[model samples]
Target: MATLEIDLFTARSDNFGVLLHDPETGRTASIDAPEQAPILAALERRGWTLTDIFTTHHHQDHVEANMALKDRFGVTIVGPGSEADRIPGIDTSVGDGDSFDFAGHRVEVIETPGHTAGHICFYLPEDKLLFSADTLFALGCGRLFERPAEVMWPSLLKLRALPADTTVYFGHEYTLSNARFAVTIDPDNAALTARAQAIETLRAKGRPTAPTLLADEIATNPFLRADDPAIRAHLGMEAAEDWQVFAEIRARKDRF
Candidate 1:
């Protein structure tokens, strides 16, 4: 199996644009074309040509450069079928449980529709990599823009059920701010405290705190800790359903 090489770079403020390349087949894809300049630059730096684009949602920031890149490289644009009307230049539409082949690798689409009614995430089982997009962030999850917390909580749990070693790449650089809110809720978490310190150090040095491991997220990310007894206890929701606990956490983050 050929290893997937990922190049992650910042685009348009806090958004992250990622390029996934397969060395063996020389096929490359952009996870989301948040902007044309950075995505094009990353492709140029690696001497790779963009052949496909995997869009997670219909948000303008995530798809703003899709048409530009497609016109330049004639790339195939893949996005959620649920939001086909909203995604520009989308050639292929997929929903949860749909699987497809990309540059000799299989990609699984997981529908996560809290942030948007049609949001989806890509999971590459072969590489153990997940492109979580806006659904799940470092220490926090995306705000419930199109659906209620009840709907979004299950989507998060789905991502959390992936292999422990799965490398998670999310949409933005909100880890530092998320860490601040996380500590306020789960103050006694030693792992979270350590993770918070590390996030601060990385931010100070101008580093990206993404591509985090699912194991670490499960251990430290408060959004993913809804099932944790400690978190429930702290929230005084010991008897609450997992989704209820999750809703409270998300609500707190909204106001944080």
Candidate 2:
């Protein structure tokens, strides 16, 4: 089967509105609905009818347009099973390790519950695409609003184990700021320093850095590198477990 065509645009604030279209079936799915107007405008631009919504979590900014879009396009909304009660207009509920179909491709649901208790991410193994709304960002992970560091660290491991080439589509545009913080934690990483310089250029040009390579994130993102010796040493936790190191990094970020 052909991979789904992707469309990404800025929505309310820094939120990224994404649309995935299957050319073979003429069916399109919105990764999340942050705003009604932008989504409608994007659909109009591509002349694609909205067929479904693959919700990542129950955050307001990520799902506020759910009912409106569903009402207008009669879209079927699929969301995390654990937080289905919180997702507006959720028609189908799925959880960790669940796989569903969109067009002829398999959409694997990975439950990442750090940002929220029932937060999830969508991964298409065939296409190596991961819609990691709020769970994993370009250079950072989401804040733990509903869970703690221990719970979130394992959730991150699930994503880390994915293919290195997986193209990650994050929900927000905080790469520039996250990069600024990253250098402080993993200062000696040459790859990270180079990536930060590039991000600085991208932000200066007003470009979006949503789709980052998982390999780059693994090499630089402090939250994902708690097990790395350099970061653990930076935090003065060389003997600590990975999750404990992650907690220290998160604590520092919360203050940063």
Candidate 3:
């Protein structure tokens, strides 16, 4: 049998909320809740209803619509173990290595604590799709708001270790801005130049540049390329520690 079908819907200005459907069982799971209208509109268009919600963290933009959606559709809300107390209407609380079945597809939970103490990413191994919340963006990463740079480093490294082919669906739509920052880090990276041009073309056509593949991000996104010798040398770093490189890239972004 073929892998399940996944559809990505960009909600609000920069958020790309995802809908994963299992045809075998006719079930659907939404990755995040940035707003209710987009999800409602998408589901109405597809003639499908939401059954489950997988939250990555407790951010308002991500979780604010949870209750409204659950009340409207009676969907089960699943979130990380660390934030169960804070997440409203959580039906199931999970942690790293936890696996659950929905619509005959196995979804594994990965603990990625950095952006938030309880941030988690959903991994569908069969499909090689990772629903990276704020932990990993297309060309940029979430601001180290709740945690220090030290905590976010390991979390990012874990996501980077996933197979290069893994398709990443991040939480926001910051690719264009991120690509602008990428050029400063690796001015000589041909991939970054090409990616910026492609992104600009898409934006000009009013299209979204999202659902970036991990391999492509590795090629252009400096955050995921912490271990690359070229990036390390550019930052004047010695060790290939993911956090060390992460710190340098993040510091530069803050000023950029």
* Alpha carbon RMSD to native, model 1: 0.8
lDDT of 2 by residue, 1-256 (tens): 8768999999999999999999989899999899999999999999999999999999899999999999998999999999999999999999999999899899999999899999999999999999999989988899999999999999999999999999999999989999999999999999999999999999999999989999999988988999999888878999999999998888888788
- Please, what is the whole-model Cα lDDT of each candidate in the order they appear? 0.93, 0.93, 0.85
- Tell me the alpha-carbon RMSD of every candidate: 0.8, 0.7, 1.6
Going through the candidates in order, what is the number of backbone clashes in each? 0, 0, 1
**211, model 1: CA deviation in Å?**
1.1
Q: Can you give the TM-score per candidate against the true fold?
A: 0.98, 0.99, 0.94
Q: 128-200 in candidate 3: lDDT tens per residue?
A: 8899989898888888877877788788777878899998888988888888899888878998899988998
TM-score of 1: 0.98
Worst 10 residues of 1 by lDDT: 217-226
Could you give me the TM-score of model 3 versus the true structure?
0.94
Error of 2 at 209 (Å): 0.7
Candidate 1 clashes: the total is 0
Sorting all predicted structures by TM-score, with the top scorer first, yields 2, 1, 3
Rank order (by lDDT, best first): 1, 2, 3
After superposing candidate 1 on the true structure, give the runs of residues whose Cα lies further than 4 Å from its correct spot: none
lDDT of 1 by residue, 1-256 (tens): 7888999999999999899999988889999889999998999899999999999999999999999999999999999999999988999999999999997789999999899999999999989999999999998899999999889999999999999999999999999999999998899999999999999999999999988999998898888889889899999999999999999999998888
